[model samples]
Target: MSPPMIIAGIVVWFTAGSLLSWHARKNLGEGMIEYFLADRKVGGFISAMTYSATTYSAFMMVGLVGLTYSSGIGSLGFEMTYLAATVILMVIFAPRYWAAGRIFRLVTPSELLARRYRSPMAGAVSAVLCLVMLVPYASVQLMGIGYLLEVLSGGAIPFTVGMLIAAGVSFVFSWWAGLRSVALTDALQAVVMLVASLLLLGFITLALFPGGLPEALGSRQDLLKVSWTFPMFLGLTLPWAFFAVTNPQVVQRLYIPSSVKNLRKMILGFSAFGFVYTVLCVVFGLAAAVKIPGLEKADNAMAMLLSSVPSPLALVVSLSITAAAVSTMNSIILTLSSMFGRDVVRTFLPDISERTELGICRLLIPVITVVCFFFARMQLGLIAVLSSMASGGLLMQLPTILGAFFWKKATAAGAVSSMIAGGLAVSFMYVQGLKPLGHWPPVWGILVSGTVFIAVSLATRPPIDTEDFFSSLEGYIRDSFGS
Candidate 1:
């Protein structure tokens, strides 16, 4: 991976992404909905791909492998659990969400909260938490881009420079095209990532492991099994089970379906795709661990494995890695900006025109780009740590969001308190050096927050107009079904 080749590969990716952005802006009409949600026009296939790409992000490439390297086989639980959770969301939540967004013309998940709960304050809270969680999560993607560049270029490009270039291009593409641009680019990137994954897997298996992956695995069988004791399993799975329900990025995906039929198709398709992709990633990590033993940390597994391959092959893998980061970063930046402009600013300054709102969203790209660049330079090992930390805090939103759409008895106060208590408890544990008795803090956070939410909602007065929430959502379902 010479400097010129590395630069050229990136230049090609950004150029293609830019072209797609231009096309999106031209066709999608620069409205906030178009920018953020692709005007709810995405069909089954693209939606599934977008969901998988966003969910996988750079973490699967870098962090999953790193985990497989350090923890052995237990990391497979992450993907298996994610697959289970996603399937449930598709079955129970996606159809309803698409309907809700279609009826309300939601630009952000917070806007959905506002409409459902009929409280500007609730919308504001949702918006704040989304922005807070997403920016850092997006930044983690940028950090992966930096890392990919650093590894491929053999340290010729500084990590900061690499992150800036990658995030800068992502921010620009997202700002220009909005949802259309992100979707189109994501579709293309997803293909690239798929090819890259398969090719790299083959290369590593045949080229590196002469006896093949199964043989290599025999030596490190311990790394391939589930590491979770019963308690650990509960801590990890329970919180993550709630994550797909509440995660803004994950739930925001529910808003993009063109029809209910399409939503069903995506659920099945994405569940299969996500399961395969995650399983392959874990396998790659485990194989890498076998090839490159004694890893001090899990996150470095991918990079360490790449170092063993030929430079040119490593470069291809690196490009796929870049695609992983860029694809997710673009989506996150677009979502965060939309949330900021629509959920936070538009509340107090409703007079701000839609055109102005779009402009504000575009302006935020650069601001977020800089922040992500700074974090990319930090010693943020693998992206999984950053993702887990953010996901843990935001996991508190799960029960409340579910209650809003499904539980009629859920009150606004209870929803608000649940989010506050859950988010705070997770943050507190992190700050206080609290660890989940050999598990993650998010596990406890989920339990504590979830219990409070259920108790409070049950104990409190019912929402003033629970029927309004369902009534508003009916139009969406009808429209989706009809369409």
Candidate 2:
């Protein structure tokens, strides 16, 4: 690991990304839809790649690997459960989102909710919650690349500098062509990420095991067994299981594919990509547990393994991890900027011109990136907890999202109350280190929020247009998907 290698990696990554961004810009139009949603004309391959890249962040290599290394088979189970749940959720929700987007020309998930709930206030509140919960989650991506660069460069490139590089790259591509650029580069990065993971696994297997993957994994049989309690597993899996709806970035992706056919491809392709990546990460984690034992911090397992590898391969793997972070960060920034422009700004300024809205969103890209970069520089240990808190915090939105699609009785007050109460409950519990009744924060948050949502909705009047909205939506979905 050397400064030159780190510099070279960054150079290569940015150069490739710039070329893709240039290509993306060639067909890009000057409109909010063009920039943010690729004019809803992206094909299947790019759509799937972008979805996969955005969904599986640096968390896969760094966080999931560490979790698997420390916890064993439970990590696999947890992640697989998330993947399965996501596919099922997508099967049900993707068509609905696509139909709504097409029918209303909606630009953001908040817009969909607002239109359904008949409340600008609902959309605004959801946008604000996304900003609050997702900024820290986005910063975690920056922090991850920063930490990896520092470790791989042997501290020649400081963590702050790495954060700057990540933030700068994210801002440039996101600002250049928006989702078009982001998705194209994400497709490239996703390929690189998968290839890099496979290469690393091969090298590690040959170097450490010498026999085969089975031998290596079998030697650590005990480490491969389930070690997590049911409560612990449930707590962690709950947020991720609902990630397709809870996380705004990925949820917004539901609106990007060109058609129902492309949307179907996106789901299936992402499912395949997720399956391979998860297996690579889990195997790597088990390998690390066997080969690089006794790490004080589980987070260091990937770094340690990389340090043990030959310099060149380690550099490649490091760049792959950096790619993961950049792809995710750029997507998050673009999605958040869209939320701000469409959900927040338009709520207050309903008559704003499309040009002004797009301009505001483009300007906010760098602003949001810089905010996340500064948060990364703080280097808070609680950052990891905040990452988990984001998923749990977002889980509070599930009832509202589901109710919007299915339950006609769900009121604006219920949506707002559930999100606010659930977000507060989850955040407070995480901060105070409280787990009510010995359950995880997410479990408590979901229970309390769901209860509040139901009670508040039953006690109050539903939206005036609830029936019309559902009836129209159902008709649109049926016509669009022919189901």
Overlapping backbone residue pairs in candidate 2 total 0
Give the Å shift of residue 360 in candidate 2: 1.1
Candidate 1 lDDT over 1-483, as tens digits, reads 689988988788778878877877788755777768887888888887877777678878887778767776667776587679768766777767777776677777778777777777778787787776667788777777776787777899988888878877787777776777777888778877888888887787778878878887887778757665766566566666766666677678888878776787778777877777787788888787777787776678888887888877777778878888888887777777778888888888889899998888789877877776676566556444555567777777887787887788877677777788888888777666677566668878878877888898788887677797787676666665653
Off by over 4 Å in 1: 378-387, 436-439, 458-460, 471-483
Q: Which residue runs does candidate 2 get wrong by more than 4 Å? A: none
Residue-by-residue lDDT tens digits, candidate 2, 1-483: 779877987899899999999999899988888899999998999999999988889989999899988888899999999999999999999988888888888989998989988899888888998898889899999988888888777788888998999999999888899999999999999998999998998898778778876776776787767889999989989999999988889988898898889999999999999999999999889888988888899989999988788888888888888889888899989999999999999989999999999999989998999899888888888876787699899899999999999888999999999999999999999999998777899999999999999999998899888888888889988888899
Model 2 lDDT vs. the true structure?
0.90
Strongest candidate by TM-score: 2
Number of clashes in every candidate structure?
Answer: 6, 0
Best by lDDT: 2
Query: What TM-score does prediction 1 earn?
Result: 0.92
RMSD of 1: 2.6
Task: State the weakest 10-residue window (summed lDDT) of model 2.
Answer: 211-220
- Model 1 clash pairs are 35-179, 66-298, 66-299, 72-223, 73-223, 73-224
